[model samples]
Target: MQYPEHLAHFASLFKKRDIAHFMSAPWLVSSFREPVWRYNFGFKNDQNLDWRVHLCDGSLLTDPQHVKLLNSLQCWLIASTENAAGPGFTNSWAAQSASFRRTLTVIDHILQSAEALELVEHGLSALTYDVMCDIIEQIGTSSYVAVSTYDWNNRLTDYCKSLLQTTSPESIDKCLEEYPTLADITPLQLEENELEIPLELISRVRAALYINKMYHSNPNGGLNVNSIRVSALLYKDTLAGKKRLKPLHSILGFIWRRDRFIREFDGVPVTNGNPDRMTRRDLVLYRTAFTFLQKISALDFKLPSKEDLREIATFKVTGTAMGRFKNVPTPIIFKAIKDGIELHFEHGPQLLKSYLNIAKYSLKHMVNITGIPDETTISLLEPSIAELGVQYLGISTRSSGRDPGTELKESKEIYFSKLRGNAGLLELIGVYYGAIQLLVGATMAKRGSELRDLDPTNCLSEDKSWLIARIAKSSRGQKGRRARNARPIDPLAAEMVQTLIDFQKDLIEIGFIDQHLPLFSSPGIIGTSSLTSCDVYLYYKNIDLFCDYFEVERDSLGRRYYIRQHQLRRFFALVFLHCGYGASAGILQWMFGHTDPAHIWNYITEELPGKELRNTLSQALSERIATGGATHYTDVIDLIESKFGTRNVSVMDAEKLAEYFDFLMETDQMTMEPVFLESDTGLRVDILVVVRKQDEMG
Candidate 1:
């Protein structure tokens, strides 16, 4: 803060620079404009952060004070660059790289964030700029590097571009005249015959040469340099740091590494391989998770640990969905009037009855019509089944569900031949299978392969509490693989499994399938085969088509939220971790099929959004405090609010909100929980803001 000659130095520079251009443009002094610079065209910057720091698009400009300072600086801006892009700052200022604008952007961000208005009241001076640097490094080191490094290579690029512009190609090629200092840099483009020169590329060199020439003649002060405004500029990095994040496009290369080449495609013929589609499906697994995290981290939000990602991957069943049904054709759906069948997930027996009735209808038409069919069996699936399904669901075209620019292109093939499974039967069955799998997977939070291996005879325990799911992953290539009896399951999951058991038992009773087949068996696609057990790959392939027809969820882009089998497992682990479910680490280890305990331990202890959600809750509370609103927990809320002093935490001291939220969580070991309990009306979900541990009896 102590600068002996800082005041004297700034006063000297203020007198030297011409200030006439400050008024050359009238808009700079007029009303304010947002995005005072134009660069990033991304998510709506609802905060309206516009000050033409013009780092990438523009800099952060906030409040009335910045407007006047911007007016004074317009003289320097106009002298060095071009016209303003909207109300923001101009591009190509002082012949700097587009990236260099980010330097000013970061500084403005810090000033506005810290509300250090006094530092900028006279524009950034030498002393104020030094104070800003100390504040910046306190935030993060890598952040400062990302912002300042924009202009780091300017000196080198200037030297190379200038040296190469004057030299002939032969001299450099023969090594007769070489520049060893430029070996690390990329080669420059220089057209000897062209009169055009890139001003931004060589301006630094030209300025230095001009200053050297003037100094040799013993010019005024022997300094001959006047670019002092830049020297006083401190690199604040939050804005510039945001611009340096991992771009969304590089996801293509992130998933497609050389080591990831499909093993099956290596020795086998690549004849039908589309290269794009064929390889993309094979590229999913842990790598997809890595890319997902990388994308999350690039944004300002904290990167999710295992628990947060699990929430994204997990599906929660709503008890109310039982009454809802998307109509598939045929009066069988209306048979509720006669057969006492109702559309509900819990009424799995009624759903099976309807499915069988539809199956019987197909058999009657096929057998009575003669010549085309010889048997009246459920195995002989008719096209009428699909005709019914298609009435309510459109066939999938096998294409993208995400933005073409943001997502990888899909590769899918449709068979032209109308085989037995081709007659819409497979599509309908696949739809049902996908929905079943989605619910079952989320409920069990286990691998699809393991779920498929469930014992139809006794997968559900006597009490219907534990689902005897086989440990396929942990049991691989080991002796006497066994199903875990301790795997606790939801009542809904037990119902779903029992539903599958009843449906397949009828198939086995009529000789449609062998009783020994896995619980996931379905009517075979092959003409001669009666049944085929479902695998992870088969279900994965059928899922997309099923999601197309089913009333599955979609993303913000209106694309289907592609829930994968693996995502389900993560959901189970996360629920147990955050909600403090009965499952222990030992139980999770056996369920997750991990080779080591550390993997399961890490997941169990992974940072929950509870900590992050604390901030969000604080923000919501702060907003309430700022608005002085009424709420249900009046006494408790008043008590909490009274802790803060008169200064508004939301506006006057925004940083204090973190402390207040921390206080709420620390008091009485309060935790946010989603619990359902029996009320006089029915079971109701509890969504309390501040839940006391002892008050939770459910």
Candidate 2:
């Protein structure tokens, strides 16, 4: 075979390596006489030619053939490296397979042609430092070192300088024109600013400069900013720009339209002298403002200092200035009375009297639970105006009223009725409220509630006894039906259901209800009550309850009764079919349920008699035959002696003998022949009589 041009070139280069050439020249000449060595010349040992080894060692040559080939190739490689030849630089072991080396070498020669090099240089420059690094790494260390020697002498300074100064001003101008908008420029500048610029505007400008530089250098494609770290920093700095460069118009917009209803009334008191007469409207607004402030305090922002707010006249006063609104907002003040009523109802009539006294005493003294002025409280109550001679607390009510006092008095009546309607209502409310309070308290206390006790069902009233009774009854009924239908009882399925029920109860107790439980309550054919007869049987065909029972029994002797359930069902079907208890159609449906008759026939024919019974029958038959027992005495003695064993002496023996005789007679004649008597003088001899005497002696 003719060697490719590049391969021939490689061979020449290898021959130039001082040590390799000196060692391989004699081997290459000798290889011509050895077919193995000749064949190895084109064989690739390291197909990928990964450039990791500093020297190709003889140890890598698995056979003498590889050794001879590598030796010749190594000499050629060294020569090419020394000469800086095209074949040396362009040849890749990956492309030069033993089967295709000639083609690959031709390709390499073509690629290194003067015409090809000139074409490549028209629009592209020499490789960069990074690209050179990649090449050096790809070539083995020995080749890399050889190439490096040449590179050090030639140097790549001119290539580096050319690339650095390659950008065109026209390209930069074109990029600037394309991205002239502030949105684009500002965002780009912001990204660059994150790396080095501290001033937001300057950083954005720097990013813009970098982008413009890349755009000018690569005019055909946009900037390729692929670094994740750089991208994250860019995003972060852009967000900072948002905070710093917020438009003046936006600030003005906020100033002009921000809601100030709460601020306007902050320091002004609705309740002056009469704390009892504070209105509901003032109370509602006061509570709403307090809620808003509480929410604000929970946020991440640094709140403005009170002194700062005071310095800025534009800033509004808040709830802090009014102190606590206990007496001033009479509705909040009246919460004590409402709470007393709630407590009284919760604890029943006995505790009611005590709470009422507490309410009366507080009312008589005009004591404040929260400390805002009475005038402010009255103002808060004005909106829910009514004429019931009681203060309106701004809570919605069905009663119509125009005066504050009437609305308040009516609200008090409404609140009392709501408290009295359900005895367990307060407890229910307490359960929910206490759970929330417990969770919050736990957060504050840093001690969590037990998961088991957090269930909603645990909070159900004792009055729900009726519901429990109903569930228990339903469960019992279901179990009873399952027991009856699964006659003799499939303990395994029963146990499975029981376990599932226990788990479900546990979930329910923990306030988690699984929707799938009801579906699993009755599973397979038994669960699908609509199925009947053979249909049910076929549905449960794959379940292997009988086999499963047998396995279970085999594993544990005491669990033998587990097989009874399936066995009894089979026995019932067999007996019913044998007894002609129903019409063929009805019996078929009953025995096999709605199954195809062919399937039923197949099952019946394929099924073996129960193992225990089959064994018992086999043992009995063997013993009878061994004893020469016979039941029928009309046997031909000669036939019996010639065919089956010598006739049994006893009737049991004769019966066992006749059983074997009958079996042989029924067998295929070609496979087995039955015994026949062939006597010159035919005597009326009974096989059973002859076998009886022999059985007795034995």
Highest TM-score: which candidate? Answer: 1
lDDT of 1 by residue, 1-698 (tens): 33357485455323432334223432232323433444322222211223434322244444454554454333333322232222223543232222234334334444444434344433433213234334333222222232223332232234335555665555454432232211111101121111133434333333333322311211111122222222223233233433332111110011100110011011111011211111111112111222232222222222234444444333221111011111111121112112211212423344345445444444445421112222222333334443332221112221123122221132222221111133334344544555566656754556566776666887888888777766653432224455364556656556666777788787666554556566766543222123455543345534444444432444334434345554454344333332222223343333444324344334333322233334333433433444444245444455455665443333433224434544556453344433334446432223246545445533
Model 1: lowest-lDDT 10 consecutive positions: 255-264
- Candidate 2 residue runs with Cα over 4 Å from true position: 1-512, 517-560, 564-585, 594-596, 602-698
The weakest ten consecutive residues by lDDT in model 2 span 247-256
Please provide TM-scores, in order, for all candidate models, with all chains considered together: 0.31, 0.13
TM-score (C-alpha, index-matched) for candidate 1: 0.31
lDDT against true structure, model 1: 0.36
lDDT of each: 0.36, 0.26
What is the C-alpha lDDT profile of model 2 across 1-698, one tens digit per residue?
45687687456533422342232321132332232232122233211221111112212222443443333333322322221233222444322221133222212222223143331222111222232233223222211221212221112222222322454545545544554431222211221221222242322332344443321211111232222223222222111111111111110011111110111011212112211211222222222221221112222223223333223322222211111111111122123223333432343232212222322333445542122222332343312121112232122211123332332354534533332232112122222222222212111111111111122332222332111111111122112311111111122222222333343354334333333233112112111111111111121221122212112222112321111112232332232222221123443343343335444434433332222122222223333334543234334444456665555544334324434432332221111111223245421111212232334434
Model 1 CA deviation exceeding 4 Å by range: 1-423, 473-483, 524-529, 551-559, 573-698
RMSD of each: 26.1, 39.9
